[model samples]
Target: MAIDDLLDEHEQSERVRNWLKNNGAGLIGGIALGLALIFGWKWWVQHRDQQAQAGYAAYAEAVKAIGGDDLKQAQAKVAALREASPQSLYAQLAVLELAQAQVKAKQLDAALATLKQVAADSPMKPYADLHAARLLNAAGKPEDAVKLLSSYDSPSALEVRGDALVQAGKLEEARDTYLKAMTGMDVASPQRRIVAIKLTHAGGTPPGSAESI
Candidate 1:
Protein backbone atom coordinates (compact mmCIF):
# COMPACT_ATOMS: atom_id res chain seq x y z
CA MET A 1 0.00 0.00 0.00
CA ALA A 2 1.08 3.58 -0.59
CA ILE A 3 2.31 5.47 2.49
CA ASP A 4 -0.47 8.16 2.18
CA ASP A 5 -3.13 5.46 1.83
CA LEU A 6 -1.85 3.74 4.98
CA LEU A 7 -1.91 7.06 6.91
CA ASP A 8 -5.50 7.81 5.77
CA GLU A 9 -6.67 4.32 6.86
CA HIS A 10 -5.06 4.87 10.30
CA GLU A 11 -6.78 8.28 10.62
CA GLN A 12 -10.19 6.74 9.88
CA SER A 13 -9.58 4.09 12.56
CA GLU A 14 -8.63 6.85 15.05
CA ARG A 15 -11.84 8.79 14.29
CA VAL A 16 -13.95 5.69 15.03
CA ARG A 17 -12.02 5.13 18.29
CA ASN A 18 -12.52 8.79 19.27
CA TRP A 19 -16.27 8.54 18.63
CA LEU A 20 -16.55 5.37 20.74
CA LYS A 21 -14.63 6.92 23.59
CA ASN A 22 -16.86 9.99 23.54
CA ASN A 23 -20.22 8.07 23.46
CA GLY A 24 -19.34 4.75 25.15
CA ALA A 25 -20.83 5.67 28.58
CA GLY A 26 -24.10 6.78 26.98
CA LEU A 27 -24.45 3.54 24.97
CA ILE A 28 -23.67 1.42 28.04
CA GLY A 29 -26.15 3.39 30.18
CA GLY A 30 -28.90 2.97 27.55
CA ILE A 31 -28.36 -0.82 27.36
CA ALA A 32 -28.46 -1.10 31.13
CA LEU A 33 -31.70 0.89 31.34
CA GLY A 34 -33.31 -1.31 28.67
CA LEU A 35 -32.41 -4.49 30.57
CA ALA A 36 -33.76 -3.00 33.82
CA LEU A 37 -37.11 -2.29 32.17
CA ILE A 38 -37.40 -5.84 30.85
CA PHE A 39 -36.70 -7.45 34.22
CA GLY A 40 -38.88 -4.87 36.04
CA TRP A 41 -41.87 -5.81 33.88
CA LYS A 42 -41.33 -9.53 34.49
CA TRP A 43 -41.06 -8.90 38.22
CA TRP A 44 -44.35 -6.96 38.20
CA VAL A 45 -46.13 -9.74 36.30
CA GLN A 46 -44.87 -12.40 38.72
CA HIS A 47 -45.84 -10.27 41.72
CA ARG A 48 -49.38 -9.83 40.39
CA ASP A 49 -49.76 -13.57 39.74
CA GLN A 50 -48.64 -14.32 43.27
CA GLN A 51 -51.12 -11.80 44.70
CA ALA A 52 -54.00 -13.33 42.72
CA GLN A 53 -53.11 -16.82 43.86
CA ALA A 54 -53.07 -15.68 47.46
CA GLY A 55 -56.40 -13.97 47.00
CA TYR A 56 -57.93 -17.14 45.55
CA ALA A 57 -56.67 -19.19 48.48
CA ALA A 58 -58.17 -16.71 50.91
CA TYR A 59 -61.47 -16.94 49.02
CA ALA A 60 -61.50 -20.72 49.34
CA GLU A 61 -60.95 -20.46 53.07
CA ALA A 62 -64.01 -18.23 53.29
CA VAL A 63 -66.16 -20.63 51.27
CA LYS A 64 -65.14 -23.61 53.36
CA ALA A 65 -65.94 -21.68 56.47
CA ILE A 66 -69.56 -21.72 55.35
CA GLY A 67 -71.84 -24.90 55.38
CA GLY A 68 -70.66 -25.81 58.86
CA ASP A 69 -71.52 -24.69 62.38
CA ASP A 70 -69.02 -21.86 62.09
CA LEU A 71 -71.11 -18.92 61.00
CA LYS A 72 -68.90 -16.42 62.76
CA GLN A 73 -65.74 -17.74 61.09
CA ALA A 74 -67.47 -17.69 57.74
CA GLN A 75 -68.46 -14.08 58.21
CA ALA A 76 -64.96 -13.12 59.32
CA LYS A 77 -63.18 -14.77 56.43
CA VAL A 78 -65.61 -13.28 53.88
CA ALA A 79 -65.17 -9.83 55.40
CA ALA A 80 -61.41 -10.29 55.30
CA LEU A 81 -61.60 -11.20 51.62
CA ARG A 82 -63.43 -7.93 50.94
CA GLU A 83 -61.11 -5.84 53.10
CA ALA A 84 -58.08 -7.41 51.46
CA SER A 85 -59.33 -6.79 47.93
CA PRO A 86 -62.78 -5.33 47.61
CA GLN A 87 -62.33 -4.97 43.86
CA SER A 88 -61.46 -8.62 43.37
CA LEU A 89 -63.85 -11.08 41.71
CA TYR A 90 -63.28 -13.50 44.57
CA ALA A 91 -64.36 -10.87 47.08
CA GLN A 92 -67.67 -10.36 45.28
CA LEU A 93 -68.27 -14.11 45.06
CA ALA A 94 -67.47 -14.48 48.74
CA VAL A 95 -70.14 -11.95 49.62
CA LEU A 96 -72.75 -13.87 47.64
CA GLU A 97 -71.80 -17.15 49.30
CA LEU A 98 -71.83 -15.57 52.73
CA ALA A 99 -75.33 -14.28 52.14
CA GLN A 100 -76.53 -17.73 51.13
CA ALA A 101 -75.06 -19.24 54.25
CA GLN A 102 -76.75 -16.61 56.34
CA VAL A 103 -80.06 -17.43 54.64
CA LYS A 104 -79.71 -21.19 55.19
CA ALA A 105 -78.95 -20.47 58.83
CA LYS A 106 -82.27 -18.51 58.86
CA GLN A 107 -80.54 -15.31 59.81
CA LEU A 108 -82.84 -13.34 57.54
CA ASP A 109 -81.78 -9.89 58.72
CA ALA A 110 -78.10 -10.67 58.39
CA ALA A 111 -78.67 -12.14 54.94
CA LEU A 112 -80.50 -9.05 53.78
CA ALA A 113 -77.74 -6.84 55.16
CA THR A 114 -75.07 -8.88 53.41
CA LEU A 115 -76.90 -8.76 50.08
CA LYS A 116 -77.49 -5.04 50.51
CA GLN A 117 -73.76 -4.49 50.88
CA VAL A 118 -73.16 -5.74 47.33
CA ALA A 119 -72.79 -2.77 44.98
CA ALA A 120 -75.47 -2.31 42.34
CA ASP A 121 -72.91 -2.18 39.52
CA SER A 122 -71.00 -5.25 40.69
CA PRO A 123 -71.11 -8.35 38.53
CA MET A 124 -72.96 -10.10 41.36
CA LYS A 125 -75.81 -7.59 41.46
CA PRO A 126 -78.35 -9.85 39.81
CA TYR A 127 -77.59 -12.73 42.14
CA ALA A 128 -77.68 -10.42 45.13
CA ASP A 129 -81.03 -9.01 44.12
CA LEU A 130 -82.48 -12.48 43.59
CA HIS A 131 -81.30 -13.66 46.99
CA ALA A 132 -82.49 -10.48 48.66
CA ALA A 133 -85.91 -10.70 47.06
CA ARG A 134 -86.33 -14.29 48.20
CA LEU A 135 -85.20 -13.44 51.68
CA LEU A 136 -87.63 -10.56 51.81
CA ASN A 137 -90.48 -12.86 50.76
CA ALA A 138 -89.40 -15.39 53.36
CA ALA A 139 -89.45 -12.65 55.95
CA GLY A 140 -93.07 -11.79 54.95
CA LYS A 141 -92.07 -8.62 53.11
CA PRO A 142 -93.30 -9.75 49.69
CA GLU A 143 -93.99 -6.21 48.55
CA ASP A 144 -90.37 -5.26 49.07
CA ALA A 145 -89.29 -8.48 47.38
CA VAL A 146 -91.37 -7.71 44.31
CA LYS A 147 -89.98 -4.20 44.08
CA LEU A 148 -86.35 -5.28 44.50
CA LEU A 149 -86.74 -7.92 41.79
CA SER A 150 -88.78 -5.79 39.42
CA SER A 151 -85.79 -4.75 37.30
CA TYR A 152 -84.19 -8.20 37.15
CA ASP A 153 -84.82 -10.54 34.20
CA SER A 154 -83.76 -13.87 35.69
CA PRO A 155 -86.22 -16.75 35.41
CA SER A 156 -85.84 -17.62 39.08
CA ALA A 157 -86.34 -14.00 40.09
CA LEU A 158 -89.48 -13.84 37.99
CA GLU A 159 -90.89 -16.93 39.67
CA VAL A 160 -90.19 -15.46 43.07
CA ARG A 161 -91.81 -12.21 42.01
CA GLY A 162 -94.87 -14.11 40.83
CA ASP A 163 -95.12 -15.82 44.20
CA ALA A 164 -94.78 -12.46 45.91
CA LEU A 165 -97.59 -11.02 43.79
CA VAL A 166 -99.77 -14.02 44.61
CA GLN A 167 -99.21 -13.49 48.31
CA ALA A 168 -100.22 -9.86 47.87
CA GLY A 169 -103.53 -11.05 46.23
CA LYS A 170 -102.71 -9.41 42.89
CA LEU A 171 -103.99 -12.49 41.00
CA GLU A 172 -104.12 -10.90 37.54
CA GLU A 173 -100.65 -9.42 37.94
CA ALA A 174 -99.38 -12.71 39.32
CA ARG A 175 -100.76 -14.60 36.30
CA ASP A 176 -98.99 -12.26 33.89
CA THR A 177 -95.81 -12.40 35.93
CA TYR A 178 -95.94 -16.19 35.90
CA LEU A 179 -96.28 -16.08 32.10
CA LYS A 180 -93.13 -13.99 31.92
CA ALA A 181 -91.36 -16.41 34.25
CA MET A 182 -92.37 -19.41 32.12
CA THR A 183 -90.95 -17.81 28.99
CA GLY A 184 -87.52 -17.56 30.61
CA MET A 185 -87.45 -21.15 31.90
CA ASP A 186 -86.25 -24.15 29.89
CA VAL A 187 -89.04 -26.69 29.27
CA ALA A 188 -86.99 -29.17 31.33
CA SER A 189 -86.75 -27.09 34.51
CA PRO A 190 -88.71 -28.63 37.44
CA GLN A 191 -89.52 -25.03 38.27
CA ARG A 192 -91.32 -24.88 34.96
CA ARG A 193 -93.89 -27.43 36.14
CA ILE A 194 -94.26 -25.59 39.45
CA VAL A 195 -94.72 -22.28 37.62
CA ALA A 196 -97.35 -23.81 35.38
CA ILE A 197 -99.39 -24.82 38.43
CA LYS A 198 -98.98 -21.34 39.83
CA LEU A 199 -100.17 -19.86 36.56
CA THR A 200 -103.32 -22.01 36.75
CA HIS A 201 -104.06 -20.77 40.26
CA ALA A 202 -103.38 -17.14 39.34
CA GLY A 203 -105.50 -17.47 36.15
CA GLY A 204 -108.80 -17.72 37.96
CA THR A 205 -111.83 -15.79 36.59
CA PRO A 206 -110.86 -12.51 34.99
CA PRO A 207 -111.85 -9.29 36.75
CA GLY A 208 -114.38 -8.48 33.99
CA SER A 209 -115.88 -11.99 33.99
CA ALA A 210 -119.66 -12.25 34.49
CA GLU A 211 -119.04 -13.96 37.88
CA SER A 212 -117.28 -10.81 39.07
CA ILE A 213 -119.64 -8.08 37.72
Candidate 2:
Protein backbone atom coordinates (compact mmCIF):
# COMPACT_ATOMS: atom_id res chain seq x y z
CA MET A 1 0.00 0.00 0.00
CA ALA A 2 2.86 2.39 0.68
CA ILE A 3 4.40 1.75 -2.70
CA ASP A 4 1.02 2.19 -4.44
CA ASP A 5 0.46 5.55 -2.68
CA LEU A 6 3.94 6.79 -3.76
CA LEU A 7 3.23 5.83 -7.42
CA ASP A 8 -0.13 7.69 -7.41
CA GLU A 9 1.50 10.90 -6.10
CA HIS A 10 4.28 10.67 -8.74
CA GLU A 11 1.66 10.26 -11.49
CA GLN A 12 -0.20 13.37 -10.28
CA SER A 13 3.04 15.41 -10.34
CA GLU A 14 3.84 14.24 -13.88
CA ARG A 15 0.34 15.15 -15.10
CA VAL A 16 0.61 18.66 -13.64
CA ARG A 17 4.06 19.19 -15.18
CA ASN A 18 2.85 18.06 -18.60
CA TRP A 19 -0.14 20.37 -18.45
CA LEU A 20 2.08 23.38 -17.67
CA LYS A 21 4.60 22.47 -20.38
CA ASN A 22 1.95 22.20 -23.14
CA ASN A 23 0.00 25.29 -22.10
CA GLY A 24 3.14 27.46 -21.78
CA ALA A 25 3.95 27.21 -25.52
CA GLY A 26 0.39 28.16 -26.51
CA LEU A 27 0.26 31.14 -24.13
CA ILE A 28 3.54 32.56 -25.42
CA GLY A 29 2.52 32.12 -29.09
CA GLY A 30 -0.83 33.85 -28.50
CA ILE A 31 0.87 36.88 -26.91
CA ALA A 32 3.37 37.18 -29.76
CA LEU A 33 0.60 36.98 -32.39
CA GLY A 34 -1.41 39.70 -30.63
CA LEU A 35 1.58 42.06 -30.52
CA ALA A 36 2.31 41.46 -34.20
CA LEU A 37 -1.26 42.38 -35.15
CA ILE A 38 -1.14 45.62 -33.15
CA PHE A 39 2.13 46.72 -34.74
CA GLY A 40 0.97 45.71 -38.22
CA TRP A 41 -2.17 47.83 -37.91
CA LYS A 42 -0.16 50.89 -36.87
CA TRP A 43 2.27 50.50 -39.76
CA TRP A 44 -0.56 50.17 -42.25
CA VAL A 45 -2.25 53.33 -40.96
CA GLN A 46 0.98 55.31 -41.14
CA HIS A 47 1.65 54.18 -44.68
CA ARG A 48 -1.82 55.11 -45.84
CA ASP A 49 -1.50 58.60 -44.30
CA GLN A 50 1.84 59.15 -46.00
CA GLN A 51 0.41 58.21 -49.39
CA ALA A 52 -2.58 60.48 -48.87
CA GLN A 53 -0.36 63.41 -47.93
CA ALA A 54 1.77 62.96 -51.01
CA GLY A 55 -1.28 62.82 -53.25
CA TYR A 56 -2.72 65.98 -51.68
CA ALA A 57 0.53 67.84 -52.13
CA ALA A 58 0.58 67.03 -55.83
CA TYR A 59 -3.05 68.04 -56.17
CA ALA A 60 -2.42 71.37 -54.40
CA GLU A 61 0.43 72.20 -56.76
CA ALA A 62 -1.88 71.54 -59.68
CA VAL A 63 -4.54 73.81 -58.25
CA LYS A 64 -2.01 76.59 -57.69
CA ALA A 65 -0.86 76.34 -61.29
CA ILE A 66 -4.44 76.51 -62.46
CA GLY A 67 -5.05 79.61 -60.32
CA GLY A 68 -2.02 81.22 -61.93
CA ASP A 69 -3.56 80.61 -65.37
CA ASP A 70 -0.90 78.12 -66.26
CA LEU A 71 -3.23 75.41 -67.51
CA LYS A 72 -0.56 73.36 -69.22
CA GLN A 73 1.47 73.21 -66.03
CA ALA A 74 -1.62 72.37 -64.05
CA GLN A 75 -2.54 69.59 -66.42
CA ALA A 76 0.92 68.08 -66.17
CA LYS A 77 0.88 68.08 -62.37
CA VAL A 78 -2.64 66.64 -62.22
CA ALA A 79 -1.81 63.95 -64.73
CA ALA A 80 1.21 62.86 -62.74
CA LEU A 81 -0.76 62.80 -59.49
CA ARG A 82 -3.58 60.85 -61.06
CA GLU A 83 -1.23 58.35 -62.65
CA ALA A 84 0.56 57.80 -59.35
CA SER A 85 -2.50 57.65 -57.12
CA PRO A 86 -5.61 56.93 -59.11
CA GLN A 87 -7.58 55.85 -56.04
CA SER A 88 -6.84 58.96 -53.94
CA LEU A 89 -9.42 61.66 -53.23
CA TYR A 90 -6.98 64.31 -54.44
CA ALA A 91 -6.60 62.49 -57.71
CA GLN A 92 -10.34 62.60 -58.28
CA LEU A 93 -10.67 66.26 -57.30
CA ALA A 94 -7.70 67.21 -59.45
CA VAL A 95 -9.37 65.76 -62.52
CA LEU A 96 -12.56 67.67 -61.83
CA GLU A 97 -10.63 70.92 -61.35
CA LEU A 98 -8.65 70.36 -64.51
CA ALA A 99 -11.89 69.96 -66.45
CA GLN A 100 -13.20 73.22 -65.00
CA ALA A 101 -10.04 75.04 -65.98
CA GLN A 102 -10.32 73.73 -69.50
CA VAL A 103 -13.87 75.05 -69.64
CA LYS A 104 -12.71 78.51 -68.56
CA ALA A 105 -10.08 78.52 -71.27
CA LYS A 106 -12.80 77.91 -73.88
CA GLN A 107 -11.34 74.47 -74.30
CA LEU A 108 -14.74 72.85 -74.37
CA ASP A 109 -13.56 69.83 -76.29
CA ALA A 110 -10.69 69.37 -73.89
CA ALA A 111 -12.95 69.82 -70.91
CA LEU A 112 -15.45 67.31 -72.24
CA ALA A 113 -12.66 64.85 -72.88
CA THR A 114 -11.24 65.24 -69.40
CA LEU A 115 -14.67 64.90 -67.79
CA LYS A 116 -15.35 61.76 -69.79
CA GLN A 117 -12.06 60.29 -68.66
CA VAL A 118 -12.85 61.13 -65.03
CA ALA A 119 -16.31 59.66 -65.38
CA ALA A 120 -14.79 56.41 -66.52
CA ASP A 121 -11.99 56.39 -63.92
CA SER A 122 -13.47 57.80 -60.71
CA PRO A 123 -15.85 56.29 -58.22
CA MET A 124 -17.97 59.46 -58.41
CA LYS A 125 -18.87 58.72 -62.01
CA PRO A 126 -22.33 60.19 -61.65
CA TYR A 127 -20.96 63.66 -60.85
CA ALA A 128 -18.56 63.49 -63.75
CA ASP A 129 -21.39 62.35 -65.97
CA LEU A 130 -23.47 65.31 -64.83
CA HIS A 131 -20.73 67.73 -65.83
CA ALA A 132 -20.29 65.90 -69.07
CA ALA A 133 -24.00 66.30 -69.76
CA ARG A 134 -23.72 70.04 -69.21
CA LEU A 135 -20.76 70.23 -71.51
CA LEU A 136 -22.64 68.37 -74.20
CA ASN A 137 -25.56 70.73 -73.86
CA ALA A 138 -23.28 73.77 -74.07
CA ALA A 139 -21.62 72.24 -77.11
CA GLY A 140 -25.03 72.27 -78.91
CA LYS A 141 -25.43 68.52 -78.69
CA PRO A 142 -28.74 68.49 -76.84
CA GLU A 143 -29.62 64.96 -77.89
CA ASP A 144 -26.37 63.61 -76.51
CA ALA A 145 -26.83 65.61 -73.32
CA VAL A 146 -30.34 64.30 -72.92
CA LYS A 147 -29.18 60.73 -73.37
CA LEU A 148 -26.39 61.07 -70.84
CA LEU A 149 -28.60 62.85 -68.26
CA SER A 150 -31.23 60.19 -68.63
CA SER A 151 -28.74 57.62 -67.34
CA TYR A 152 -28.30 59.40 -63.99
CA ASP A 153 -30.20 58.61 -60.80
CA SER A 154 -30.64 62.30 -59.85
CA PRO A 155 -34.05 63.89 -60.41
CA SER A 156 -32.57 67.28 -61.34
CA ALA A 157 -31.03 65.67 -64.39
CA LEU A 158 -34.56 64.79 -65.46
CA GLU A 159 -35.44 68.48 -65.60
CA VAL A 160 -32.30 69.17 -67.59
CA ARG A 161 -33.05 66.39 -70.03
CA GLY A 162 -36.61 67.65 -70.33
CA ASP A 163 -35.33 71.10 -71.31
CA ALA A 164 -33.06 69.48 -73.85
CA LEU A 165 -35.99 67.55 -75.29
CA VAL A 166 -38.04 70.72 -75.48
CA GLN A 167 -35.29 72.47 -77.41
CA ALA A 168 -34.86 69.44 -79.63
CA GLY A 169 -38.57 69.81 -80.63
CA LYS A 170 -39.64 66.53 -79.08
CA LEU A 171 -42.61 68.28 -77.46
CA GLU A 172 -44.52 65.18 -76.45
CA GLU A 173 -41.47 63.60 -74.85
CA ALA A 174 -40.55 66.86 -73.18
CA ARG A 175 -44.04 67.20 -71.73
CA ASP A 176 -43.87 63.68 -70.35
CA THR A 177 -40.48 64.37 -68.84
CA TYR A 178 -41.65 67.66 -67.27
CA LEU A 179 -44.64 65.96 -65.67
CA LYS A 180 -42.25 63.39 -64.24
CA ALA A 181 -40.33 66.26 -62.63
CA MET A 182 -43.52 67.69 -61.05
CA THR A 183 -44.25 64.27 -59.59
CA GLY A 184 -42.06 64.89 -56.49
CA MET A 185 -41.30 68.59 -56.23
CA ASP A 186 -43.43 71.34 -54.65
CA VAL A 187 -43.88 73.27 -57.90
CA ALA A 188 -44.84 76.93 -57.36
CA SER A 189 -48.17 78.12 -58.78
CA PRO A 190 -46.50 80.34 -61.36
CA GLN A 191 -44.21 77.56 -62.54
CA ARG A 192 -47.20 75.23 -62.66
CA ARG A 193 -48.98 77.69 -64.91
CA ILE A 194 -45.95 77.90 -67.16
CA VAL A 195 -45.87 74.10 -67.34
CA ALA A 196 -49.54 74.11 -68.25
CA ILE A 197 -48.85 76.43 -71.15
CA LYS A 198 -46.00 74.23 -72.28
CA LEU A 199 -48.17 71.12 -71.95
CA THR A 200 -50.92 72.67 -74.07
CA HIS A 201 -48.39 73.51 -76.78
CA ALA A 202 -47.17 69.92 -76.55
CA GLY A 203 -50.76 68.74 -77.27
CA GLY A 204 -51.63 67.78 -73.67
CA THR A 205 -54.08 69.01 -71.03
CA PRO A 206 -52.69 70.54 -67.86
CA PRO A 207 -53.58 69.36 -64.36
CA GLY A 208 -56.85 71.10 -63.13
CA SER A 209 -57.11 72.74 -66.66
CA ALA A 210 -54.98 75.69 -65.52
CA GLU A 211 -52.95 74.35 -62.64
CA SER A 212 -49.77 76.01 -61.46
CA ILE A 213 -46.37 74.36 -61.96
Best by TM-score: 2
Report the alpha-carbon TM-score of model 2 versus the true structure. Answer: 0.79
Kindly list the per-residue Cα lDDT of model 1 for residues 3-24, writing each as its tens digit.
6576777798898899999999
Candidate 2 global CA lDDT score:
0.77
lDDT of 1 at 92: 88
Global fold similarity of model 1 (TM-score): 0.74
* Clashing residue pair totals per candidate (backbone < 3 A): 0, 5
Candidate 2 per-residue C-alpha lDDT over 32-108 given as tens digits, one digit per residue, 9 for 90 to 100: 99999999999999999998788778888988987777788888888898789777778888889889889989999
Q: After superposition, how far is residue 45 of candidate 1 from its true place, in Å?
A: 1.9
User: Per-prediction TM-score, please?
Assistant: 0.74, 0.79
Error of 1 at 55 (Å): 0.9
The regions of model 1 sitting more than 4 angstroms off are 1-37, 204-213
